[model samples]
Target: MSAKVINITMNGLPMEVYEGMNVLEAARIMGIDIPTLCYDEGLSSYGACRLCIVEIGPQDRTKVVSSCTYRCEEGLEIRTHSKRVMDTRKMILELLVCSTPGSKTIQDLAAAHGVITARFKPEHEDCMLCGLCVRMCKEQMMATAIDFAGRGPDRRITTPFDEASALCRHCGGCMFICPACSSRCMGPDADTTLCSSCLNLSPSCVEVYDHQQCWMPPGCGTCIRPEGDYLPATGRISEVKTEA
Candidate 1:
């Protein structure tokens, strides 16, 4: 059976999309840009990062919904860039920066949204708690090696018991899927042992600390590039491209 289609109005423009599709996918099909952090088409819509939020409703009543996970409905009205939506997005970015000021991903996103600084004290950590790595590990790799632990501000991503688990495939999938980890190892740190290529014995080494471009040198260790589509800095793997 064919899937049903949904008709929606976005920013005064009317469009038709597939039923059961999320607002983000519908918006992208219409060329509307909705910034996101924890969204990947290959994984479940976790909605952990509220950056892709959009306002949805009628003239008198509307509410903000995470576009990545909010399924589209017929006769739905969406406002992607209203004052309320932008304000919410800005605040979300501010909080993300406060949590991970050292992350270039967060920094770049905040700058783009004119979030000059965080209102809260910044944590020195790089992980953004996006849950992409955790999703990939469990769903795709079936490793279930890492997950979010703790609660409130104490929550963080880590291996079980904070120790390396034997269930870890060591496939470097978590490092590759992480937005913070992508540019984290670009430098020649005193602790070179922390490098993924060094730890995995992969020949492809990325100079993340190089400051200009994240360059990957060949022949240091095996390099695994994501298949199907290519992304610049994030390097997230949607599908398995190669193993060597």
Candidate 2:
């Protein structure tokens, strides 16, 4: 079978790729690196981070756009890291880091771009609002247990009515896939919780916990408790009967 071809240019370098492939994937295949925090190979393009912005066009060149969401088209020209693009990306990373200072993903991205510190004060405690948790829950787990609750800055991840998620299988997939949760503790106690840092720094803890079953308590019942009986016994009668 003949493969479909799509001609494009990267930094003035002419290239040909498949018709349906995304610009970011095509560029990666061609050894072009576009820094991205929200774009994951396993998940769909979120385009929330806006770090992988690239200039694309031919005659009338368009403004810098996210390469992760943009598809490669015939005769398309892309500039992965122009001066303007780099500056914009840096600002974006700075803003994201300012919002979520504790996020390792944001810190790593900032460091990669030579950003020593965030310009603005930290606003949020956790969660960058990248929508990764919501997307993963819906798409991968096929459980619409939680989602974005509000709009703009007030937006947060939550189940319906901010209660325990019934649709959730407790698979912990959302927590596992979350970059924010990656660095937190997992046990009943916050201090004893297992985080990504704990896992990496103390690999032996995983084995010890597994052998001791520290994470899972013993004598745990999977079944639900039966409701209490309200009806009285057939042989039992009231000693002092009052007027009904």
Per-residue lDDT for 147-196 in model 2, tens only? 88888768877778876667877655665566654443222333222122
List model 1 lDDT by residue over 6-99, tens digit each: 7999999999988999999989988988898898888899999899999999968999999998998899999999999999999998888676
Residue 22 displacement (Å), model 2: 1.3
Candidate 1 global lDDT: 0.69
Candidate 2 residue spans exceeding 4 A from truth: 1-3, 58-60, 184-244
Clash totals, every prediction: 10, 4
Q: List the global CA lDDT of all models.
A: 0.69, 0.64
TM-score of each: 0.74, 0.72
